[model samples]
Target chain A: MSGEPANREPVDLAAKLASFGEHWSPRVVAGFNGHDVMVVKVQGEFVWHSHPETDDFFFVLKGRLTIRMREGDVTLLPGQLFVVPKGVEHCPVAEEETHLLLIEPAGTPNTGDPATAATKHAI
Target chain B: MSGEPANREPVDLAAKLASFGEHWSPRVVAGFNGHDVMVVKVQGEFVWHSHPETDDFFFVLKGRLTIRMREGDVTLLPGQLFVVPKGVEHCPVAEEETHLLLIEPAGTPNTGDPATAATKHAI
Candidate 1:
């Protein structure tokens, strides 16, 4: 191989999700570089937040969700992806149960502003 | 938001594989940089070959597989990943059946040294 230690392989989202039940909170599923990848099941709405130094990337593995941006909204369906540019305030809402892949720096706050108790480090 | 156009998002291997039925051959599911991300169903033995200028990364999405290399063999199970470094002559054999994610530069040969008829560009 690349002479590098193999990381976690063949990740199964279904199995991972089966291990927990929660909303908003995410669990670390994998890591690459200095970033953490988290998988979360979301419904309803998340708090509006902004990561000053980090960009957020989300992939909708299942269901439907919308990223509400200050200037516009990006509605995502399965196989669709969108990135919220750094410093942009946004909120995510799920019309139904959704499975998503969220990528950001390892320490990124679930709540961009982190001014409330709902902000979590589930990852 | 990296100020870049969004490409395909939130890929689901199951859905992609559902659209095709084949073995060894891969179908392009996504692209990043100059690389193509493919999903493949593989069983039995593959050819021994090498890509002098490219590295290949594999993630076992399901099942088990063994990479036979001149130096040593790397056996992979689900949730384990391995990268075949550039210029290594290796073959993959699945004792049972397997589903895998293969990432490599666009146009990389399926049979690395390519002197065969089974070689394909299903992606």
Candidate 2:
């Protein structure tokens, strides 16, 4: 939260989540400074990856999320958060459909690498 | 989410919120880069002030929060978030006991001023 607020646009998390209908794809809801607050619906599993330049913030909104890492696995329920450091290989898996709020650098991709299939895409 | 995640220590939002007992005072639950993630149980109204250097991120976890500013007031419900840009005077008011997750620069005082009573405190 280090940006200008001349043009304020309040975001309704519930409404924003309702408009999106895809899993593993994040929709940008808001931005502050150089970070973007995104929401994504995830199921099954996502490929293992890491953001070499920035950290990843994950807050579970619905259901549960398991973040697998070489060291161990992190399980997050609603109202829980886990931050995976930059350059740490990890994979996110969900037993069921899970809604998550992610805070990261604006251009960060789900799979970390820009050339990966999970790279930048539609909001 | 721009900090290094080495020596990661995940946080349980629900548990941290439960461990705190004061209102208007923030308890630091996590730190990333030069920022801190805090959880506070807020009730009543807070002082009006502005952080000249860094913006403030507010995510309501329970009940409701009304962030009063010169232009207008922003209402946030559970799962909703709002960012007050740096240098913008704002006051936080809650109708009842409300739980909140705050993201801001580390050592940031709740009053935006270091000399205020709401300045840095023990977690």
lDDT of each: 0.70, 0.80
Clashing pairs in 2: none
lDDT for each residue of candidate 1 in A66-90, tens digit (9 for 90 to 100): 8887667778886555666667777
**Segments in model 2 whose C-alpha atoms lie over 4 Å from true places:** A1-9, A117-123, B1-10, B117-123
Single-chain TM-score of chain A, each candidate: 0.87, 0.88
TM-score: which candidate is best? 2
Clashes by residue pair, model 1:
A9-B79, A9-B80, A10-B79, A79-B9, A84-B1, A85-B1
Query: For candidate 1, lDDT tens digit of each residue in B35-57?
Result: 56688889999888877676677
lDDT at residue B71 of model 2 (Cα atoms): 79
Q: Write the per-residue lDDT of candidate 2 for residues B1-123, one digit (tens) a residue.
A: 333434444578888877768888788776555677788899999899888887789999999999998877888888888888888888999999999988887877778888884644545
Model 2, A1-123: lDDT tens per residue?
233453455567777888877898888877666688888899998998877777678989888999988777888888888878778888999999999988887787678777774543334
